[model samples]
Each structure stands twice: as C-alpha cells, then as structure tokens.
Target: MWTPNVNTFFQIFLKNFKTRKTDDFSATRNSLCVTIEAVRKFTTKRRKTSVLSKKSKAIGFIIMSAFGFAMMAAFIRLAGDLPFTQKTFFRNLVAVAVAAVVLCREKVGFKWEKGNLPLLIIRATCGTLGIFCNYYAIDHLVLADANILNKMSPFFAIIFSLILLKERASVFQYAAVLAAFGSSMLIIKPGFSSATFPAIIGLLGGMGAGAAYTCVRALSRKGEKSARIVFFFSMFSTLVCVPFMITDYHPMTWGQFFCLIGAGASAALGQFGVTLAYANAPAKEISVFDYTQVIFSAVLGFFLFGQLPDGWSVLGYLLICGISVAVFFYNRNLERKGQ
Candidate 1:
C-alpha cells in the first residue's frame, strides 16, 4: 500500500517494449515473404508467355518456309523439260550470289574451319545430287507427290545421324523410321515400270538430302559459318553442273528462263525462312509444321496442273504426317518431364 518502486516500473516498461518490437519484426517478415512470392509468380508467368510467343513466331516462319519450298517446286515444274543439272546450276547460281553478299557484309572472308573441307565436299556433292533427283521427280510426278517424297528427308536424317554422327536412336525413333519407309512404299508402289522410276528417284533425293544435312550438322559442330557453307555448296554445285549443262545445253525460252529464276528466288526464300525458324526455336518444337509443304504442294498441283494424288498416295501422306505428329508430341512430353 506504499508508493511503487521505480526499478519495478522500469523493468515492466522494458518487457512491454521488447514484446512490441518482436511482434513488429514478425509481421514485417511475413509481409516481405508475401511480396517475394508475388514477384516470383509474376516472373514465372512472364517467362511462360515469352516462350509461347517465340513458339508462335517459329511456327509462322516454318509455314512460310513450307510455302516457299512448294512454290519453288512448282516453278521447277513450270520450267518444263530442262535438264535437272541445268536447273540446279541456275538455282545454285542465285544462292551463290546471295551467300557471297552475306559473307562480304559480315566481313567473314572465305575462310573455313580446318578439316571441314571433306565434309563440305560431301555436303555439296550430296546436295547437288539431291537437287537433281528432286527436279527429276518434279518433272515426272505430280507436285504433291514430289514434295511428299522429299519430305522423307527427316526420317532419312535420323538414319544418317546414326551412321555418320554416331548418335544413338531411341526405340521409338527406330520404329518411326521403319514406319516412314513403309509409308513411302505406299507412294512409290514398287515395281519395274517407268512410272515408278521417278518415285524411286525422289526417295533417293530424300536420302541424299538427309546425308547432306548430316554433313552440315558436323560442319556446324566444328564452328563453321553457315553462309560460308552455303557459298561453298553453291559454288561446287555450279562448277559441277557446268560441264553437264554445256553438254546437254537446251536454250530456254524467256518464259522458261523466268520460271527458273522464280524457282531460284523461291528456294532462297525457303532457306532463309527455315534458318530463321530454327534460330528462334528448336527443331523438335516446329519441325512437324514443315509437313505443310505437302499441303501447299497439293493445292498448287490441283489448281495449276490439274493434278490429284491417287488414293494410295493420299494414304501415304496421312501415314507419314501422322508419324511426324506423334514423334513431335512424344518429344514435347519428354521435354516437359525433364523440365
């Protein structure tokens, strides 16, 4: 019942102050955690959106590439009865000019990575042969048929990668390759007839292109420049074709000459479009869209040349495209799991 002790009062005040400070610190920490979580969510959503946008752009570029290649095939058909070598020469001539300009602009000079020369020669030889075969198919078969046949290159690429790049394939990849070959037989209708010859040649074209692609992959791994690679292939093809073109020279009408030029330009468009596409996204993500070339070729063939694929050919197309779609999905699934 006497006056309160000063020390007792002071100690009570100090305890209350300590409790208040601790509460404030806990509240602040909770608020900071919440803010961090919100920031993380916002950044994750932005990253997902960015990936989707890039994929969309890649798809668009691939579709453009498909149309360009289809148009190039149509122009080759329109050129009419020209030797495949002659057509190849003109096509490579345009590529050479374009590649030269690119190199000069970049100031990369004409230098190549050492030990790349052999692969370059192989790539050029195979590319030249592939073009010759493809041109022959375009001349002989309907445009859709020729284009679909050439589309077999990706499957052939898998096989070549196994042999040349020492890459191992999954069981699914091997099965897909077999399925693709079976599908090609439906289009080819294997026989000794002259009608089947072009289809066979078209298959060879796909194989050659696959081999050339493998060589290109090897060159790229060795740090070779893409423009230099293109320039070398174009120059090699042009020089090789010169002798054949001179021997089998057939003067072209202005119409035919212009058609060939259109073919060359269209091919360039296709090359650049595909390059842009792969640059933006991985091949597995967008490669399936490349089958659109068959669709474009079909439409062009029907309208321009009044050509229609037979039932067997249509079946082949469906099967091949289905396999591609399946592989594409499988790859996406694996990528998602890895992530």
Candidate 2:
C-alpha cells in the first residue's frame, strides 16, 4: 500500500532534471510520469483490496446476525404456550438492560434530539407491533416460515423509505419488490383456512418491521445515536406490553423463563451483529446474506420440532432468495459501472 510521497517524487524529478543535459529533459519528464502512474496504480489496488476486506467482514457479521435471529426465533418457539405480549416484554426487558449498560459504559446520556421524539415514538410503536406479530407467528407457523416472513422487512423498508423519506428507487429495485411480493404468496397460500391467518399476520409483522426500520433510518440521518434509539424502543415496547402481559400472564416454569431470557439475549446479539455489519458496508452489499437465517431456522425446526416446509414453501424460499441474490448483484454491477 505504500507509495512515493509527492515531495519525494518531485525531488527525484528535480534531481534527474539537474543531472541530465537539456536534450534529456524529455526523458526526465517521461520518467516522472511513469513514477506517478505507478503510484496511482498501487494506491488504487490497495484501496480495492481494503474495500474487499471490509465487504468480507460485513458478510461474516451479517451471517452471524442471521444465526442470532434464527436462534432467537427458535427460543421463542421453545418457550411454550405463553402470551405473545408476555414474551415480547421479556425480550425487550433484556434489550433495555443491555442498552442501559451500553449507554452507561459509553457515558452517553439518554436524550433525544429535539423534534426527533415523534419519529422515535413511531419507531418504537411500529417495532413493538412488529415483535408481537413475529412472536405470534413463531408460536403458530413453522419456524423457518416465520423467519422467512420476517426477513421480508428489507423490501418493506424500501417501500416505506420511498414513502416516508422521499427516496427514489430504481426500476430494478421496484421490480425486485414486486417479485418478492409474488414469491411471498407462494408461502402465504392465501385461503379461507385458520392456518393462513397467522401467515397474513406474519406478513403484516414484516411490514411493521420495515416501517420501524424506515423510521430508524430517518432518525439516524438526524444524528440520533444507535444506543439511544435502541434504548427508547426497548423501553417503549416494554411499557406498552405491561398491561396486556399482566392481564394475560401465563405461569412459566423455570425452563420456559430461561427460554425467554435466551430469546432476548439472542435478539441482542442479532441487533448488534446487524448494526456492526451495516456499519462496515452498505445493505446492498451484505443484506442478501441475512437470508441465511432461514436455513438456520429450518435446521433448528427440523431437529427440535420435527417441522419441515412443504413443497410450496420450499418454492417460496427459493424464489425469494433468488430475487434477493439478483438484486444484490444488480446493485453491485451498477456500483462498478458508476465507479
């Protein structure tokens, strides 16, 4: 990665110019040009290597995030028959504790920037609702199905960003969205059956998550700290769940209690992993890797719950994942051309 300094280059050029005759001036100038070109090539190569290294790290972090989320979903399913709200409370309770510790360690006071309160509320509200729907889905649907449905948040985020943030999407992105929606129908398999209800709710949960993520993007752009945003959402969700949790509280055995705790910890791992991932690289680069959660969930479901997705569900997974891969490569190609 090292290259000749500008000063050093000039010094060499001047020395060559002084040592050579007037007839050799052209040769000296050409030599300097060659040196400059070499340096440029070296630096460009180093930069590309650095970027590749960062993308590698981002992929690893995102994969870890996927596994963390899959584990969280599995733990939720393992918690047995309990109120979704009650489970949500425990999840956020752990988040609140973790967020509080982070804030304390960072010495960042819990203060929202003025005019950001409304967006914070929106983020928390949507996030709480999303969690409720997701927990319910985990309780009712197959674990992999629930995981894949929730993973639809990114596409939903695109739509919400367009609406809320006034961001414009390209034709390919919109096409990807449409293809994703059509693919999701393969899993939803809409009908007048009781089973389909949870799938619909799961879809709505993905939409809520997308909306919440959209708000988070806005807040981040407005200079909100990640820790504060997480703390606010965790606290807000915890309080929102209090009343329902109290009223419909089901007694949990020690095992179930620990399972919920495990869910919360795994969720925190996912949250932090994703945060680190995107910090290293843009979503377009690493987001497709998040689909790994579906595979992880499928493995867990099969071994633990004897759950296996049927043929249609498998088709849905392939289409959705394929669409994501296409979108990812399309975005990368555009970036390369722009560069």
Candidate 3:
C-alpha cells in the first residue's frame, strides 16, 4: 500500500536478483550455465518487480471495485426504465440511509468549519448533479461503455490541477491526459450520432466527478475526514433529490428495491476503497492506476453485457493506460527527490 519512492523499486528489483542468483545458477549447466542463470535471474527479477506488483494489485482492486460500480450502473439503467428523477432520488435516499448507519456505528462526527460550509454545499451540489448525469448516461448506454467514459475523471483532475492548483505539469502527466482523452474519443467516437448525447453526458459525468475530486483535494488540507465529506454529500443529495422523487413517483417492485440496495452498498464500498487508497498512497501515485477501470469495464462489458470495444477503442485504451502509468512513475520519481 505504500507508494514507493523511485529508489525503492530499484532497491527491491536488485534485491530480488541477488536473492535468486544462487538458485538461478543451480538450475543451469556448464557452457550455457552463466547465460541461462543470468536470464533466469532477470526473468525472476522482473516477475517480482515492485512496480509490477503495485500496479497489478492496484489494477486488481480497481477491477473488483469497478465490477461493483458497473453493477450499480446496471441498477441505474434498470431504474431508468422508470423516470430518471424518481430513480435518482430513490438512489440517493437509500444511499443517505446507508451512509448514516455506517457513520453512526463508526461514531464519525462532523465539525463543520464556517469557511468550509460554502465549499461543502458546492461539493454536494456537484456530487448530486454528477450522480444525475451518471445515472442518466448509463440508462441510455451500456453500463460498461458508460463506465469506460466515466473513468476519465483522473485525466480531468490532472488537467485541472495544472490550471487551478498551479501544480507543476510533467510531460508524462500531459501525455497521460492526452492518452486518456484520445482513448475516450476512440471508445465513444465523439461527434458521431451513433454514440449520441448520452455518451456526451457520460463524459460530462466524468468532468463533474473530476471537479468534485478537485474540491475534495482543496478541502482535504482543511482537516476534514473524507468520510464526513462523503456523509455530507449523501445527506445533501438525499435532500435535493427527494422533492423531485415525490412529483415523479412510481411504485417499485421488490427486485428494483433490491437493485437499489445493491447500488447503494456497492457505491459506498467503492467510495471507501477510493478513500482508503488515498490514505495509503499519494494521489498521483494512485491516480494513474485508476485507468485500469477502463480495462475492467471493457472485459466486463464483453462478458456480462456482450459489449466490446472496437479496434480504435482498444488503441485509445492503450494510450490512456500507457500515459497514466508513465505519470505515476514520474510522480514517484519526483517524490523520491523530496519534491
């Protein structure tokens, strides 16, 4: 869970080789022994690479998390079969109840800063609208496709950091952002009517979430617990969404109620995992790994929903993945130098 400095990867990589060298040599014979031993050691070394291990575990976590999130989307899609406002309202209402129980059990109390009130309200508004777009988008598109587009939030975060936070932009970060956007375009094929407005809404959802993240980052320094922030969001979203739900009310079947429960639980889980990730690792260190959500979405889409990314979409996915990884290392290296 620790985000290793650049030196950590090098040290770990070298240590693995040294530790395996003897066993590696024993497996080989006379003339080609040395070469084979070296190759064996190298292979083993790469296989045990800290970078690869961190990335693999990070990606795995994301895949599991994304599956839950995708299911949430599927629930939203089903809910969309009714009215969007009504569905969204119920979803947020359930989410509020769920979050409240968790917060109560944990004794997570909130002490609102007078200065942070406006920011809190703003973030809550953004969160509500973001959820609206996300639910609306998934209703019109495949759950996996909508998710793939939604995963672009990190790219937007990187860009916004540069513009708003005045954070230094490394070439790799720029490349990662470009890759993310390019891949998204490939996946959705912007301006194509075949993909239509829902795709754009999905993209907007990413932007909205991206803005929410930026606000989270901004308020993070103000010493608020992430859970408290999430709690507030759920509370406010429930409040705002309730009025709309009553006007557009529709009776729900038990199946739909179950789906709503599942969506709330999964979303809460994913949000907690994300918060834990930041607690365990730096934002930039963990941010790039988020792109793995797309890979997960693509695979899940194909298997669960019979949705597949086209060749162009595949290419874009690769670009996004490559750049995001590059940015991770770039940031890690910077962190190593105490930047």
Candidate 4:
C-alpha cells in the first residue's frame, strides 16, 4: 500500500535526523526520543552502505524470489497427494487475498478496461496452467530436476518476445537459448522411461510460464499496474479452478492444508520479488541469479526427498548455468559498447 519511492523513503526516514545538530539534546520527534548518538549511529550506518547499489538490490531480489519459489515447490511436494488443480487454486486464492488486502488499503481500482479483458484472461489462463503443470512436475519429479526444467522459462521468454513482441535476438542470445535446450535434453534423457513424461510436463510448465510472462510484458507496456495484473490473474485462476477442484479434490489433512497455504504465500512473495528485481535492473543484469532456485531446490530435495542428480544431470546444470551467466555478461558488454 502506497509504497514510497527511494528518495521519499529516505527523506521521510531521515527528516528528524537531518534537522538535528551534532550537539542536539534529547527530544521526542515522533513518539520516540531522538538523541545525538542515535542520529550519529544512523548516519554512520548510512555512510557504510554507500556500496549498496541498485544492481545489488536487484540481485538480492532475484535471489529472494528464487528462494521463495524453492520453498513453495518443497511445500507443494509435501502436499503431493492433493490434486494439482487444488494446489493451484489454494496458491492463487492466498495470493488474491493478500493482494486484495493491499489493494483495499491503497484503494486501487478492481476494474480494468473491457479492451484489456482478453489479454488479462489469456495471461491468467496460461499462468494457471503453468502453476498446475509445475506443481504436477514437482510431485512427480525430483525437486531440483523440476526446478531446473522450469528455469527454461527465461529462454522461452526470450523466444516468446521474439515472436510476440517482434524483438530481435542476437547470435549470442540464440546460442545461449540453444545451449539451454540441449542441456535440458541431457537432463531429461527422455526415452522409454516413466520419468520422461514428468520431465516433458515440467518443460511445458516453463513454456506456459514463458507465454504468461510475455503477456505480462505486453500488459505492462499498456500501463497496467503490476499489482492489478497479479490480482486479476489470481482471481481468475481461483474462479476457474474451483469447479475442477470440487470434482476431483482429494481431502487433505489440516497440516497439508496449512502447508499449501504457506506455499501460496511463498508464491506471492516470489512473484513480487521477481517483479521488483526486473524493475530495479535490466533483466540481463540480474536474471542469472534466478538460477539459484535450482541450488535451493537441490538442497531442499536432498534433505526432504533424498533426491540427487546423477552425472548427466550435474553436467546439464553446469551447461545451463554457464550459458546463462555467459549470456548475462555478453549482454552487459554489448550494452556498454552501445553506450
């Protein structure tokens, strides 16, 4: 609700301190004593934070988003006996509730133009399917493997941007995309195996997410607020899935119900975190940190599920992560040259 800009936040936060002198006596400014030592201490900490730049903040956001999603996935696995549709419904329901609270507090519009209705519906549909498929994959596949497969979204996002946004991809970008696909194939090794199906589904989950995000970008270009987009998506998904959930829902215990709710809460944080990451820095500059989801999932899977990747899977991780990091630096260098 009414998030202030960086300048406004700092200005409001430091106003009283700014008005004080080095020898100002103790006095309450806003229900708390403002002593000279407290002012000096805050100033010292502020000066010590000179090295914390926007890029650092963006990377921090990306890492947080990754971690949040990893925790979400782990919880989804913990609730594996439930239907994917049920899990998706709860996840979006919780997100919608949180978003509703913020929207009501901010008094934001719950309505949009009829023209944007189609795009919003398309976005919500794709996003709902993406979450459904991702949760299914998490239940069927190893947590780390499912996460790695879902990480294909960034590559597919670029591809979707090319097709839907008429964006041009450079040779290096194309190379990285190809390398990511190759590595995904290596990890899946899909032939005459039951694991093949879930791996394929995980890849499709990434595709769905990629398409949904492409729609999100288009919505942003049309000046839609991110909060509004999230709220609409969550509301749409919850409504559409409720009927299906009622028909096929398996009853979950109280513990499972709360875990799924926690998964939903985590998903909301992940969504907000990634949104902030890209808002603060260029996508290329910070997207590499998104891969840390695989790491977090790997650790969680090891302890929670006793899952570990084999030799080929490890190689696949290296290939994908290496290409992603390379792509980031390559784009950064190109930007520098253009400047």
Top-lDDT structure, candidate number: 2
Candidate 2: residue 96 Cα off by (Å): 1.7
**Candidate 3's TM-score:** 0.69
Return the TM-score for each candidate structure: 0.69, 0.74, 0.69, 0.70
TM-score between model 4 and native: 0.70
Candidate 3 local lDDT, residue 36: 46
Point out the higher-scoring one by lDDT: 2 or 4: 2
Could you give the candidate ranking by lDDT, starting with the highest?
2, 1, 4, 3
Residues 1-339 of candidate 4: C-alpha lDDT, one tens digit per residue: 122356644554476556656434453344124444455565555543432355567668878988888888888778758888898889889989887887788888888655788888988888888887887887788755776678788777777777887766666666666666667666656443369899999889989887877777677667666677889999998998989987998888998999999999999888767755655554434555676676677678889889877889788778867876686666556544542
lDDT of 2 by residue, 1-339 (tens): 355578866765666556655656587777678767766766776666666666677768778988888898788878988889998999889989998999899999899898999999998998888998988887788754666678788787767777877777777767766676666566655443357899888888999887876787688778777778888988999999999987898999999999999999888777667655655655434555666676677677889889777888688789867876786667556554544
Which residue window of length 10 is worst by lDDT in model 3?
27-36
Candidate 3 local lDDT, 39-79, one digit each (tens)? 55655555445444554455445445555665566556544
Q: Report clash pairs, candidate 2.
A: none
Report the CA-based lDDT of candidate 1 relative to the real structure: 0.74
How accurate locally is residue 35 in candidate 3, as Cα lDDT from 0 to 100?
Answer: 46
Per-residue lDDT, model 4, residue 186, is 63
Instruction: Point out the higher-scoring one by lDDT: 2 or 3.
Output: 2
Give candidate 2's error at residue 40 in angstroms: 8.3
User: Of the pair 2 and 4, which is ahead by TM-score?
Assistant: 2
